[model samples]
Target: MRIFVCIKQVPDTETKIKLMPDGSGIDEGGVKWIMNPYDEFAVEEALKLKQTAGDATVTVISVGPKKRVADALRTAMAMGADDGIVIDCENSLDSFTTAKALAAAIKKEPACDFVFSGKLAIDDNAGSVSQYLAEFLEIPHVTVVSGFEASSGKYVVTREVEGGTKEIFELTGPAVVAANKGLNTPRYASLPGIMKAKKKPLSELNLSDLGLSSSDAKVSFTNFELPPEKPPVKFIDGDPAAQAKELVRLLKDEAKVL
Candidate 1:
């Protein structure tokens, strides 16, 4: 069996984001990049599946600038993926275009038995790529998956839904699964694995190579800006009854919640 895991390079969660001067996008300077945390779960699940299958190969794929995204792919290799492919596109693309590029890249390789990815990327939180990718590939897909098992040539998975319940599915053919947190514990890259990852095969492709272009983007972002700063807190000074009256007055006249 062959498994493919899709990942993204994103600003570290703790990093303080700054907008570009012209409000076109976030400023990339001095930003720390890491693999999307949810994608790590996808990679870990893929590795676990490969280990169980024993004859399976896991390949990592990402779409971004080669310099940065290659690091994410290498991290996956260090975590035991066999090799990786980088779809080298420097500009940020919409979820549609990104999924289209990924599907095209997958088609250029040997037929894969399954595709895995994060439920959503942290940067945009659009949570739509996996669905778009599945549509582009003409395969079944389950998103926000928190459980998985395989038997009788079928995949049994559970996805979290509204009301704290989980929906179960059994897929008998190739499909895409977007992993959520708590599915598995992602392993850290050991020193030896990191060193060995330097030698693993890493291939690159461009948008044109995938029969896509910037014009394919269905959405465009502009006028990026931070949220307005919150106003300072005000204190109501008096005894308990007076305070209550003042609070009610403030809510009704100033805050307007009541």
Candidate 2:
């Protein structure tokens, strides 16, 4: 089986990021970077699938500044992805534009049996890339999947839903799936594995290298804004019953949700 997984480098979840002065982007000064947490699940799932299919080849692909993305690829390689593809795009566009670039690179590779990605990147939280790729490739797509099993030439997946419900989906080859947190625990790269990754093939390509250009995709972020800061929190001191009543009253009056 040949599986291609998309990964992303995002601001470290714990970092306090600031917006750029122009208000159109983030201020990259002190913000640290890490592999998108959700993508870790995608990597783990791919590694697990590779384990089941001993001859499988798991390739990790990302689009970003080459220097910045090596850390992200190293994260996947530590967890056992066999090779990496770093699409050397300026990445000045949003997620949809990035996906189009990724699709172009994916087309350059041998047709993959399955394509997978994290549910979404934490930074932008635009959970549309995998679905868009599936649409572009004209293949099956499933998202927010918590569990999966492949057997008898088909894939059985459990999709998460509201109110603790799950939807099961069965699909065959040439499909896209989005992974969620509970699917697997990501493995940390060992010292030896990190060393091994240095020798692994990492293909770097630019837009021209893939015969793609920004004009081929259309998407834009008009502006960027942050949510308003919260008002100071208040504490109502009283016994349990009184506090419950006060809480309900506060929610209805202040928060405006009953």
Candidate 3:
């Protein structure tokens, strides 16, 4: 069996982000990049599935600038993926165009038995790519998956929903599964695995190679700016009863929540 895991290179959550002077986008300088944390779960689940199947191969795929995305793929290889494909593209593509590019890239390789990805990228947090990919590939997809098992040539997945309930699904054919956190513990890259990853095959392709272009983007971003500075806190100086009245007055007149 062949499994494909999709990942994204994103700014580390702790990294301080700066906007471009013209508000076109964030400044890339001095930014620390890493694989999306949720994608790590997807990769770990793929590796676990590979271990269970014993004859399976896990291929990691990403769409982004060559150097950064390639680095993310190498990290996945260090975690046990067999090979990788990097679709060289601008970092700002919308989710639709991104999914289209991924589907095209997957079609260029041998057909895969399953596709795995994070529920969403940390940067955009759009939480839409895997569904779009399944649509483009004409396959079923389940997102926010927390449990996964395989039996009888089918996959049974469990996902949490609103109201703290869980929904289970069984997919009998090739399908896409977007992993959420708590699915598996991601392993850190070891010294030997890191050394071996340096030799793993990584293919790079361009948007044109995938029959896509910048015009295919369905959404555009603009007017990027930081949120306004918060106002200072105000104190109510009064006894308990008076404080309650003042709070109610403030809420009704000043804050307008009443």
Per-candidate Cα lDDT values, in order, are: 0.93, 0.85, 0.93
**lDDT per residue (tens digit) for residues 1-258 in model 3:** 999999999999999999999999899999999999999999999999888888999999999899788999999999989999999977658899999999999988877889999999999889999999999999999999999998757899999899979999999988999999988889999999999999999988999998999788998888999999988889998899999999999999999997
Colliding pairs, model 3: none
The per-prediction CA RMSD against the true structure, in angstroms, equals 2.2, 1.9, 2.1
Model 2 C-alpha lDDT per residue in residues 10-41, reported as the tens digit of each score: 99978987887778788888979899998999
Q: Least lDDT summed over 10 consecutive residues: which range in candidate 2?
A: 89-98
Runs in model 1 with CA error above 4 Å? 235-258
Clashing pairs in 1: none
Return the TM-score for each candidate structure: 0.92, 0.92, 0.92
lDDT of 1 by residue, 1-258 (tens): 889999999999999999999999999999999999999999999999988788998999999999989999999999989999999987768899999999999988878899999999999989999999999999999999999998656999999999989899999988999999989899999999999999999999999999999789998889998999988889899999999999999999988998
RMSD of 2: 1.9
Name the better of 2 and 3 by TM-score: 3
Q: Lowest lDDT 10-mer window, candidate 1? A: 148-157
Clashing pairs in 2: none
